[model samples]
Target: MVSLLKNRVNIASGTPSRIKKLIDIEALVLSRLAVILLDIHPDVKGYSLFTLPQVRDEFWDLYKNYFHQRLLEGDLRICLYGPLPSGNEFKGKKST
Candidate 1:
């Protein structure tokens, strides 16, 4: 479940606009997971099942923090395998 959530987050980060536009999908998945988790572990908190707004906001915060760190370190390109956004293009150099 953690892995699946992580994958979804990664994908959302890549194309935030697209994710935002199709937020129903994200909400559905999250809600379903939340229901299952809650059913199995009643003691657990429901914060993990944040609404679409929460997920979107939280994801951007995390993404910004990560991007800031890479930018400060002068890393030219950030290549996330999933939904995370690609980094700024560095002129006159190949990322590879």
Candidate 2:
């Protein structure tokens, strides 16, 4: 018996190359913000943008203190947009 399949290659055997582009941290943040606001595919959570040692210091300074605050506020807005539960909902619940 012969198989009709042609060129069955093992895709996992190949390794990818690292191509790093040095971009201004401010510009990178702004472009990411634009993509998020515009409802682009593969959103912010899908990326790991800051990995290079050259941008580590600047990335932490801009992201951890500034960008993180903005993201938290955005989350707050989304969280508060729905009907919230009242204390009455927990009247019969016991603390475990």
Candidate 3:
């Protein structure tokens, strides 16, 4: 997760509206990238990401500071799924 607003602030270069637009752009690009990757590799059901504990904590802090309000009031939800531990193909997987 990129801290667009904080980074801008650190370098002294962001308005509230500008930061909002940058965050939105990043979210949109990441969403689209997921779709594109799925299309490119049908066997790739999804991705698993890991982070250092400190980084994970920082991410939550950033999320609380920036996105908590929008998440509570807006139509947004987090979805998680369990991919097969043995990879994408099951014993009797069907072919597309």
Per-residue alpha-carbon lDDT of candidate 2 for residues 12-60, written as tens digits (9 for 90 to 100) = 1110111111123232333234112111122245322222233334444
Query: Which sections of candidate 3 miss by over 4 Å?
Result: 1-51, 83-96
Predict model 1's lDDT versus the native: 0.36
TM-score of every model versus the real structure: 0.22, 0.26, 0.31
Better-scoring candidate (lDDT), 2 or 3: 3
Q: Candidate 3 — worst ten consecutive residues by lDDT sum?
A: 32-41
Best model per TM-score: 3
lDDT of 1 by residue, 1-96 (tens): 888667543223223444344454554232222111111111134222122344446556543643445545565243432222223322443432
**Model 1: CA > 4 A from native:** 1-51, 72-96
lDDT of 3 by residue, 1-96 (tens): 477555422211133344345556663332222111101122344323212233335445545766565557653344334432554333354422
